[model samples]
Target: MKFMAKIELSRHIPLVTLIVLVLCITPPIFATKNCDFPAIFSFGASNVDTGGLAAAFRAPPSPYGETYFHRSTGRFSDGRIILDFIARSFRLPYLSPYLNSLGSNFTHGANFASGGSTINIPKSILPNGKLSPFSLQIQYIQFKEFISKTKLIRDQGGVFATLIPKEDYFSKALYIFDIGQNDLTIGFFGNKTIQQVNATVPDIVNNYIENIKNIYNLGARSFWIHGTGPKGCAPVILANFPSAIKDSYGCAKQYNEVSQYFNFKLKEALAELRSNLSSAAITYVDIYTPKYSLFTNPEKYGFELPFVACCGYGGEYNIGVGCGASININGTKIVAGSCKNPSTRIIWDGVHYTEAANEIVFSQILTGVFNDPPISLDRACYRK
Candidate 1:
């Protein structure tokens, strides 16, 4: 409910210049908890992306990671993402990106999340005639390949390969999914009407459920599936659809309706999956309510601005340009900058969440309340 006054000096400075100054002045925070989980395998879009897409994306640069790592670590936030917090909670090291070959270590599992990843391969509807290469299906293939190679090495008596128990790793490891946001958003952005997008919900949920089934067949038993959040509250959505009606919390109402519908179907599909895979402890995480609550009552969660982007360039809500956009000032190019207090903001860079927001959501997920069947990650992991 409270808003920080825009910095007068920053208004005159180039965005890039302001970000460099902010990064230099800001100090990183270090806080982690201990929990019990052998390993975590994450697959999703930007919310869980730990840099697997950095090689082909722009998030692995300054400003994006300025708040947390002080530089890009391939995450789309100012600090550690939700998956990072989950890993740290279990006393595990930050999962390495499956794409990064340097010092590849699978001892603690690998993150297959990539920014802009979608649920379907060709996308529900392609607006730009482009398909994301790292779809959920592709990420799953990468996971299968990683496990296969590791198994082969362990079988051949390779040293250090035995650190991960070949037979139990996949079965014991926790599989967490945070996808589906892109599929819905892309559908809307591609000029698909709300009705048309709604029509694709069954197919989207089908693909998602099918992927879970495939993972289950591959030996995964513990699953933590995150439902799509309220995309209508995203700064990017609001900016793109200025005429859209606002909800009680000032978010775009129509977009959120679509998101709710998607979550409903996803939850139903997950229920059916649970029935089919009786051996799998599948928990559907309701990410929408917790995240939407933060926006509705920002003060309750220590956030000042819930809908505005902390890092962006040129727009009413700072959603016109991406976090890394650059502008020329008097023939000299200056990069777009971020907010001074990212911790006080909910949305980060128009599309992602700040580390603070992620922490809050992570806490909700840990409590077991947001999960279907009311099972926490710890319960799902340790259950026999």
Candidate 2:
């Protein structure tokens, strides 16, 4: 029997060697498929805010979640932000805001956006004093760093930890950005012409590109950047416009034109980023069109009042003059009210969209949700 075994080994030695070589040289084809490991990072503002600022500010019951929370959760809308809907759609747990202490689980993700936050630091306003800027929010997120090397929270099963060991930044994570609107609004108010705004656009894009790259350096691979909606048609901005006559569609032609230009330029920049940074996956959603559509055809869209919010008094829809709640002015009780059906309307207030509208937008984004498709950090990272 020993002799027979020796003869067999000698005859099949080459075949055995070939099998070993194949196992070492080629990986299983199925292993390279989708990585549904779940997302871990998010960045954006009130549009996607999951009740971040609402907890910090103080106001009467009238100024808060009257339509939903029946009080305030700190979120300045009728109900949830866009981020909440997206997370829910993805089957991930609801996200928690960075500055607050409401949520304990960091395994899923965290929302670093604050209400009244602008991409430009020190450039935001809220009912409760100044708001957090994009730069500041980024700083705040760094502390609770989700990177492997800077792991503030470790996993028992080493799920998130294994992907990004201590100090490793770019594990299986997704970074989102819903910005640029405030920059345009502030620029418009600051005497900057559209041409001037256009001039600054490139620099802003470059800075954002650089910032995203920095996030990539920290280990983020998936990115979702947003475009501005028809800013010219925002209820309050229209009130601010001194010259243009309102088109029945509620679209301020000039303002919409500016938004159009920004989207065009931003599109080009995003395309360039995708092509140049093929290693990182970057996805851009056209929030401008869908959001603008709600305003353009409010009636068709089941919106009874498009120009004014449901939570304000009088026709002007001014929150300070008794909006969000019914305030007592000089002993005279003032009260604002929500619409009959918030689900049908889009704008929650003069400047923001309602939960209903957010759901609508989220559905639209779902059709082409972009991110690192399980691999190729270079293609999905959005950073060169």
TM for every model, in the order presented, reads: 0.86, 0.76
Candidate 1 residues 24-94, lDDT tens each?
87763321222246778899888888888875544445788887688988888989888988888888888
How does candidate 1 score on lDDT?
Answer: 0.82
For model 1, which pairs clash?
15-337, 16-335, 68-78
Most TM-score-accurate candidate:
1
How much lDDT does each candidate structure score?
A: 0.82, 0.63
The residue-by-residue lDDT of candidate 2 on 70-176, one tens digit each, is: 77666657777666666665577766665565544555676666665665565445544345544534633553464533354454445544433233323566677
Best candidate (score: lDDT):
1
